[model samples]
Target: MTPNPATEPRRFLEHLYNAAVRRALPLHNTAAFLPPPPKGRTIVLGAGKAGGSMAQAVEALWPADAPLEGLVVTRYHHIPPRPERLKSRIEIVEAAHPVPDAAGLAAAQRILAMAHGLTKDDLVLCLISGGGSALLTLPAEGLTLEDKQQINKQLLNSGANISEMNCVRKHLSRIKGGRLAAACAPAKVVTLTISDVPGDDPSIIASGPTVPDATSCAEAIAILQRYGIAVPGAIMSLLEQGALETPKPGDEIFTGHEVHMIATPQQSLEAAAQEARAAGIEAYILSDEMEGESREVGKVHAALARAAAHRGQPFAKPCVILSGGETTVTIRKQPEGTPRGRGGRAGEFCLGLAQALQGQGGVWALAADTDGIDGVEDNAGAFVAPETLSRALSLGMKIDKYLDRNDAYGYFRQLDDLVITGPTHTNVNDFRAMLVL
Candidate 1:
């Protein structure tokens, strides 16, 4: 069979994304960080997009004779298939993500309950990653699951960064922000984390369920106020009185606990860079801790790519630019009776990139969430070609109209450019690559 040369760049972009994801998989990165078999049982409690995979990794590596059992919660459809001849000891459950639900609330309550009755000889293995905040939902005192879900949805569309969102989540949650760690005290907790947040701050990843939090309820209140999210009087009273403050550094509960960041955005980016270099393509990696609105970041990347392609001042031709990090999108209010927009950070980025490129030749780009879903949409992300804008215009698709409505998914779906990889079962946040030839 002959391969089409015209699609080579697009193929390479997908290859690069796969390489980045491979580097962050728990099977590849978790063994070395595994702790010694505990004198008592090893209770694995976790929640996130990667929870199922991380549990499988632990099951694959741990001694078969050791006592291993517990439950982990992951997003719906995120549980990977068990390998042939691979027996299961730990239980994996699925729940809603990016928003709290009744299932998540039940799972969180069960996980916290399991933490009780632990002895000093027991080992509590916490597998944490991105999306854990929503998957492991346990509303604080006086707050209902519905309240948490509404607040979560608001914060997601409020343009707040991950840290700010997590802060609020920690303050409002019964299990997050070191409360889980506190619950498992005397059991010697060990957290194996896949970092999906900027700076790999343990406190922000999964709202730091098994780690101490430095943020206070006051700070969370301030963030909510800054974003114009109205807090109920009951929750407001708790925040103002500092009754919901998270466990801080030097807390007695974390005396012997340990946290190991097994995978991170920077490491994944480096892995992709290595693969690009092996293919004889010069690669440059921007920071892995970038944070901002998705469209603006896309414009900045477009400018850099254009400068490299046109001027050749910063970078030479035939090169690839890579980056990783989480970005936010402020959902704009639509006109009454208008349809809601569909898409996530990656799609929005492509919208801005395609508009700014203006059909510039010799450049192609792909932006995707490593877990293979952008926002709640079914696409990992989308592709941007030199003729992206022109093709859309020819199809009667207005780039500005979609951008205004935050409808990158709708715009890209019409052009058949959406990248759908389903669930990879692991998340290192967003992956972006631009190929300039």
Candidate 2:
């Protein structure tokens, strides 16, 4: 008999999540996007949560006789366990994510240096993914690493969307916004990336290090000002003068460059839906380009789940609702004596969902980042059941208070509901599932 989602909701949900992740694995999606070995040496350069896996895929598939060498940097502990028999050809280093660190800065510099002297006959294979913006950090002239880190923190807490944030990042970086591609002038550059941003715009992924940037310095300046995030005075002057502009579309340097999206949020969501269907559950994908405040989105999802459960208006019984895309959480200020809340977008969504659900029967939900890490926290996300609100109440936990402080991590931990999955060596942004039976 098929397992019932009502009886084992968490297990069923996790199975679907795993299926989604497996669909985006580099080993499964990289082969088709791989270019034939060039006449000259093939140099690989990459940075992201999936850098290690992407490198391994190339190493395994490329002709063992052809020359292959370069560097890739991934978030610390994100490298997948190497197959014992597989020989490593690319250098995979570890660094920080969501925030740039000294290690990342060094890695970006090295990756840039590798492209400095490529010939027309050489091929540059760039393995980029979602976290590349933070992992590959080469600051612009006159800017310190400290400046980038501080601005990054402000952007994260500013509730700025991915596009807006990346726009700003492209202007401040020495290697992003098509600068990497510009460096490989006269050489063939092939970029194989996994899409984590909504709409899967190649330029927006990892700040489009290898793709021509359509965003301009003026736009970046406007985004920074709109968010009230200040920058160093010199950088602001450069932006105003258009001295920090990135390579735009139609730039000659990008001639013959190719970008292939190996995996994407929509594909992963479809994979999850297929898994649910195979298990005898009807699944509906709400969207793969969702954005906005995490808590508000959760409330909207709650409304949908309640409607399906009570009236079956939009979707009938025994069905799963799914969504993908990155969401933002604007950190709320705390009183001087109080500690700040800890949690990412996924956790915040759950808190809002649980509160809005009001203990509605026969409803369960799971929200997580496909990369297996939510924000900067250890947990990927969190889960919610019908009794979530009531259980918290029993433990002297008030959902409203937690929501006020954006304390989804604390709230979920108290209920033993936080989803903890170590780095899955891939990223396609957020994954959410709601089961209404």
Candidate 3:
């Protein structure tokens, strides 16, 4: 017989997070996922917030006889506490994220150099995960790291979606798209990724270093133009002339390349739903492909949760609504002369939920990033209890004004309700759960 789930709601949430974290552990999944060691030198190279943990995973699985040596770059503070067994072989380098820094630039150059002139006998194992697009910073010729930094900041604030943003990145990069894979010609490359993108397309993940390039220079230019991003004319001309050619599909450069998604957002959401079932709560995953403006999606979620809380239209009460996928914020719409708010999708979703709930007193919810960071803020996400609106009103906080400034993080922080987990060493996008009891 199954035991009763006596844990409180917050505890249950933690249990779900722990379960998801467990599935990500390198010790658990490394053996079966391990690739064969190369006949020659086996070099490791990668980037992303989860790069550190991924490197450790590979080291743990690799035979001691194999020649394993290389470096991985991860977001600052995202590295795991390494065990004695794997720490010495794989070097974990720290880099600035969501923006480029000198260290990241240096790391990118080094990783590029590491792939130089290898025979088919040599092997290159890449541990890629979300944040790699930024963590693996390689500026195009004549472009400074600052230029990349400025553009990256603009892209984040722009309403551009992941694909659009990555398209621009691929064009302006020396290592992204298929450039990195091209650098390691004749040397077989295998990439193991933990996907944070909605569709889990490897070419979209970290801009597909070893994968083919379906997006072209023109597409990148159009994406930049659609968002009103103005780059130098020289850069524009280079793209227009197809000077930046990423390796295309069937480019012989990728014949020996292999890519695999080791984990994904959908998988994480499924883990949460399974836990809900054990608690006797019927769980329905709304969609794993959710995207669009964060606040707007939040409002939509609020309506659904409210309906379930009141008339049980789309779903009955006592059912948990779950979803996964990244939601974006378009800061270009913020009110005039107002600083954008300090939160991400998770917090914004809660704001919309709390506003819609309006003290309804029956629904509870949690939204968070699997990587343990939401947006550009320090918090992963936030939780909304049944009395959230009541508590906010008592504290004299205006949800609409905070929402207007795009300051969802600040609002949640004031209430001491922000979820901060620092780096979970994994990314599968966002995880959301709404329970109506």
Best by lDDT: 2
Model 2 lowest lDDT segment of ten: 1-10
Better of 1 and 2 by TM-score: 2
Better of 1 and 2 by lDDT: 2
Scanning candidate 3 in windows of ten residues, the lowest lDDT window is 1-10
TM-score of each model, in listed order: 0.98, 0.99, 0.95
TM-score of 1: 0.98
Each prediction's RMSD over C-alphas, in Å, is: 1.5, 0.9, 2.1
lDDT of each: 0.93, 0.94, 0.83
lDDT of 2 by residue, 1-437 (tens): 33568689998898888989999999999888888899898999999999999999998898888999999999999999999888899999999999999999999999999999999999999999989999999999989999999999999999999999999999999999999999987899999999999999999999999998988888998899999998999999999999999998999999899999999999999999998998889999999999999999999999999999999969998899999988899999889988778899999999989989999999999999999999989999999999998899999999988888888999999999999999999999999999999
Instruction: Kindly indicate the candidate among 2 and 3 with the higher lDDT.
Output: 2
Ranking by TM-score: 2, 1, 3
- Candidate 2 global CA lDDT score: 0.94
